[model samples]
Target: MGGLTQFGQGLILAAGLASSAVNTHAETAPIEAHAVFSPQIVSGSDALRHVAYELVLDNFYDSTGVLQLTGIDIFAAPSTKPLAHIGGSGLAAALPPGVELSADNSLSIKAGGHAVILIWLALPRDIAVPRVLSHRLEFKTQTGAVQTVDGVPVRIDTTPPIIIGPPVRGGLWFADEGPGNAQSHHWGGLIADNGQLTIPQRYAIDLFGLDAKGHAVAAPIDKLAQSRLTDWAGFDSEVLAVADGVVRDFQDGVPTHDPLAPQAPTNDLTPTSLYGNYVILEIAPNIFVHYAHLNTGSVAVKIGDRVKRGEILGHLGDTGQAGAPHLHIHLSNSVNFAGSEGLPFQIDAFNLVGRGTEGEALNAESDMHLSPGKGKPVHDAMPLNGDILEF
Candidate 1:
């Protein structure tokens, strides 16, 4: 919800039905909600299609007490059956961390304040994707008044996903903190900059490489504290362009992180610090590809340089907000990081090789115990969370 607060100023003044109250006695509902993005059905490694997006809920009640959210249900438009439902503890969990809950453990929105609900709805196999989705929210006020709101619509984006080639090659790579993981930092990341809200990392993915023995590092686990930068398997590996494009924006000369002290120093942190020594390529009109956290001075192309597919852009390294050596890549609608919305793209081809332990990275345990095997061939699909692939 970092960048979401700015929406309040204009959204409160927006002229429309944010929520429609069902109780005949009540003319309108005080709580307003709408989907932030028109989501697309993404194919995940779990064999399920996912519709991932966020809902911005603004409480306009000028009363003294908070609005307690009781339940939430989503239905495919024109259908009576609910596609998903959450209530009680589940609804509470859907709210972002640090959101205050009432005494009954329900999400409570203070009067005139707003909250964001993260949604990752997975469609069952063989189910038809709906053209649009509608939401129904149930709430109770402090005075024990129960109310219902209906018909907040979210249209589905039906355009085919963008297809591109691998950004790295000749190794076993794992999609750490990738899509399909509900707890992934990339999934819930929101940026509020220049009075605008953007979801630049919604479809982003971080890649960590593995050796022939399936280890993420060249040194033993116990020696990580004493290891060198080269000890990380992916360090200095060539990062290639995923498609033909022009270099639109980039930054370099940011110092690399020390292996013995990986956590970034708290002082002087900025958006550029989050993606040290990165490059952006405009692959198409209004569509850009971002490759971040490369080694210092390794950026090979300058702004306005045209590049071809699979061209070497830089060597991956531990820089920016990265704790360990890995490549963070994603497609976006704008060149400015944290100022644009993330766009879903597909890998043209690869071989699924293994799976890493989810929600764990940059540590001895996560690197040493990857499950290894020859997996199936994947074509034009996103490599989901913890999925291992060979390119």
Candidate 2:
């Protein structure tokens, strides 16, 4: 392995983790698993950064008899003793039922099935990550007999993508770490298969701003109480292109949904509704940038239009499946909206303002929410959960 090297203006280093792998096994157990994992995890301070990855298990059994996946045993490379045993039932506390760490990590060829398992291994800061991650699993039959399954291996990379930071300067923003913790609500699972790889939203992120007091919004205590677009900090805020790119595709005309307002019964969200009024930029040859939930009639660019970094693209709004006015953004390998694989990115520069949960960021006093983070300014680092980053 070569030594780490800095790339571009960002302090980020690319940990030769460009190599990826996939394996399938069905010999020992009736349930067959196929999976992929990123070999690299960005380093951080006291907290442990996770190496995100995914697993797909095809339960080859009928509905009459379902197999319950009990738990996963995590192990570091070159060591035999397990490091952590995360239970599926325990995962339900944090995630929706059915995926990895659900009520029962089980399988049955039936109406509702959890197609993939999205997971991340805890990586400590500055520590030499293991070369390969060994995950051993077990499944149970209805009769209570437990059958251990083969281990799923994932590589660990200590580097991250050498991408730049917020396209706009002096902007207030923070990453919402809650929504995508499980299977990343963005690129969660096998959305579309292009034969070479299975694309999952392993690194999708939502960006929002803080109120004058540092809260996500200054709304009423009631969850359903109305908060005008102007009342929220980021509403109508300019959405900038993150990099020099050409507008490959775009969407608009969808009316902005009123926040906290009761509405007549309607159909659930569709692809268009989920990402109301959006834009896609081909920043690189293979990488595409997606900006979702823009205010209706606020898009300034059009398809095929060449755009530079920090260029005005649109204004943030409460549209689609959004609860409030905020910006939803992510990088993908393909131009397919919510159908392609997600990619990780880094920012050029951003100030750490505060750190807290969604509830804490809302309930806490403004003085504390806007308080300076103890850590120094960050360059080329992936935003972790509960991080309130200011640009």
Candidate 3:
């Protein structure tokens, strides 16, 4: 999802898969296939520039185990000439039943009647430009079982991403520190009680665009500001679920360290080392909402469990990838963090404090509050807190 380009022409490649048997009988077990398209660049004429994308396919199931893949097709429109095929190596393999691949090329074999087929695709350069490229994978199986899994159609954009309602309505507080103090800073995104992206930073980071550095430029902190240690833990925070979703993935129990702390001696470490306390919510088909930086032992959900929007999944604290205590939320296409692509979203309504009077809302174009300070005006703007705001 991250690699798609605006030029229309592109390539589709097969990644790999993870398989499992749902039923005791090998013949009746479901075939869960996962595929990944590693990052690649496409180069054509002067009019076209090299653009890269990463494609991931997860848990595509063939219940009857009847179909074997034949080939994959990608449909795309080019800017210049009609593009034909891509160039790159692909990966495919059989996975052990129920053991999903944690990363590309890493497979866990399990004892079960079911086998998995994994595919990886790499695109070639010199493809035509300005054409719509759609991927259609062909498969054949002995059982000819009908595929019953969800498939996301390729996206060509026109409709801007939408934020559902208001930010979660609750007491908003900032951990107090004197102005210009960097040691006690915090950061968080605003969400509605229903768990939609409503805070201005969400869109600014996800949509308004990125800077030359490729990081979310809309973040409240500049490079200098982010570098300040005191800015990390200045705000108190809590974890709120953005939508009704299943807890598909999680990690916890990692120790919190200062961002300025020295690195560990050994790179190989626990899952907690990287994620701290984290949760991945399957909000929609191939769409997952990720929450990170939770307090240790604060996770309220477990793998395979269900949660409602605005439910207390965990408490906010300094954890993985954090400078201080705050909630980091993002929508993605895959449960695996590295395999997923961020999706833009919006929240309904909330007062844009610091820009005008209280009870005002902010929109994509509105100038809203950015950082902690006093005497800021609150404006009537889009609601980002937990109140349901109608678009």
CA lDDT, every prediction?
0.72, 0.59, 0.36
Tens-place lDDT per residue, model 1, 1-391, is 0110110110000111123334555324587898878898887665567787788888876774687776677778887667777665555545553454576867777898887876777765656988998988877877878766788899999987788889996787867766654345565566777777778888888887777655566665566667788887788999999999999988889888765454545433244657788998999899899888899989999999999999999999877877667899988888876678888888888888766552233344444344345667788788876677888
Could you say which candidate leads in lDDT?
A: 1
- Count of backbone collisions in candidate 1: 1
Candidate 3 lDDT tens digits, 114-158: 222221222333443322234433332344432322222333333
**In terms of TM-score, which candidate is strongest?**
1
**Candidate 2: misplaced stretches above 4 Å?**
1-28, 36-40, 43-49, 76-83, 88-90, 93-115, 125-131, 155-162, 177-180, 187-200, 261-273, 362-369, 372-375
TM-score of 2: 0.76
Clashing pairs in 1: 3-192
Higher-ranked by lDDT: 1 or 2: 1
Off by over 4 Å in 3: 1-155, 159-236, 258-260, 263-273, 354-391
Per model, state how many residue pairs clash: 1, 11, 96
Please give, for residues 219-312, the per-residue lDDT of candidate 2 as tens digits. Answer: 6545424666776667788888888999987888878867654434334323354577888899988788878888899989999999999999
List the lowest-lDDT window of 10 residues for candidate 3. Answer: 178-187
